[model samples]
Target: MNVLAFFTATVQTTRGLWRIGQTILGIIFRHPIAGTSIIPILSDGRIVLIRRRDDGLWALPGGMVDWGEDIPSTVRRELMEETGLELTKIRRLVGVYSSPDRDPRIHSICVVVEAEVEGKMEVQDALEVIEIQAFAPSSIPQEPMSHDHYRQLQDYLNGLTTLA
Candidate 1:
């Protein structure tokens, strides 16, 4: 092979090996990440949910807690980012979910909170959120939701504080 072709192959091989090594190291040393999931209740008592762009399924509005940010801040940021709503008040803690399989993308511990929210419902993070809507408690979609959101919502609706 030409010297140029050999050099190109070597560079590509090195890049691929570097990526594989990074992935392995990341998995080995990674800890469970903390995040917040907000069950946003509007003034009229409707629950706000977002359709995830990744799975095209409805899930609670929430995200990973940014470095140096507390749970409340993460809740507020994620709520606004996903649903364009401002937190009026945090009503209650729905649960702390630490199951390794709760999120398919990563092993994340989610702090779920029921919060009173106000503002127009728009998709703030278009890349992550596909659609935003408010549903009556009795009318939440019955089909399986993204991640473990179904269990989270059910626990909230049942007035139970969970720790799992």
Candidate 2:
């Protein structure tokens, strides 16, 4: 590996690297917008979920933020990109989830937000999503969810916020 890549990886584990990301997010993205994920709740009290085309596992519809994107905008953009739904109300920031192993990629962080829908919901990103449906929170399938999406849902269910 290149010396700088090796150095950042090595030094990233040092005591303050953890907070560095939060600090950077706080400064640049304007609220520690580590990354934005969204949980879209429908009017019937069911939450919208989707199965990834690549992995075929259910997950909340979201993706990485663009370099200059803010959290709120990123959440909206990803919601539209992944599920074709627009967020009308950001109920709350569900939490932040970042475990080294939570994502397959290194140095990747995710922010989870819960939102209410204002318009129609549809499966638009057919290339990236295989299935879309509204599911009761109580009936969520036990089958593994994509990228620890199940865990994020659990965190919301248990009223746990700000996971790291």
Candidate 3:
């Protein structure tokens, strides 16, 4: 009857149908979904991360790529929705992470990028992000990161030092 309940019911029903489609189509096709993650580095060299509401792990700002959206746009959209930071500039492509085991949710190819952000980053949606923080690469949490986020950070850091 209420809006929240109605939304929940709708989402649940949609999820059920989606899973059924996944099962049926997966029998013959291997289409991997696309996702985007952003590493927002500040002027002080600290990177921004969000504490996910579902798992309480501090991870990079990102989400699944929406249909008909380009990777950069997906990155910007997810960053804004999750971190409330507008993407002023995209620095570079960090990498394309496609390890099947990276995320347990589904088969996805995550395009990672380093981006420069403007404005304060508050958790825009409590359902997706619980808290937000910036950390020097050395001080980032070692365990319980949502997916392959820590590995992505290491790759980016390695590239940075080697370039210097």
Q: In the order shown, what is each candidate's alpha-carbon RMSD?
A: 9.3, 10.8, 4.5
- Order the numbered candidates by TM-score, best leading: 1, 3, 2
Q: Model 3: how far is 108 from its true place, Å?
A: 0.6
Q: Lowest lDDT 10-mer window, candidate 2?
A: 12-21
User: Across residues 1-164, which tens digit of lDDT does each residue of candidate 3 receive?
Assistant: 99998886776577457555654554458777778789998878789999997788889999776558798888888898788888989999888888877877667778889998888978876667899998887898787689888888888888842110
What is the alpha-carbon lDDT of model 2 when measured against the actual structure?
Answer: 0.76
Q: Write the per-residue lDDT of candidate 1 for residues 1-164, one digit (tens) a residue.
A: 99987876776576446545544554788987778899999999999999998899999999877658899998888887788899999999999999998887778889999999999999866667889999999999876899999999999999999999
C-alpha TM-score for every candidate: 0.84, 0.76, 0.79
Worst 10 residues of 3 by lDDT: 19-28
- CA deviation > 4 Å runs, candidate 1: 1-28
Q: For each candidate, what is the lDDT?
A: 0.87, 0.76, 0.80
What is the Å distance of residue 67 in model 3 from its true position?
A: 1.4
Model 3, position 66, has a per-residue lDDT of: 56
- Candidate that would win on lDDT: 1
TM-score of 3: 0.79
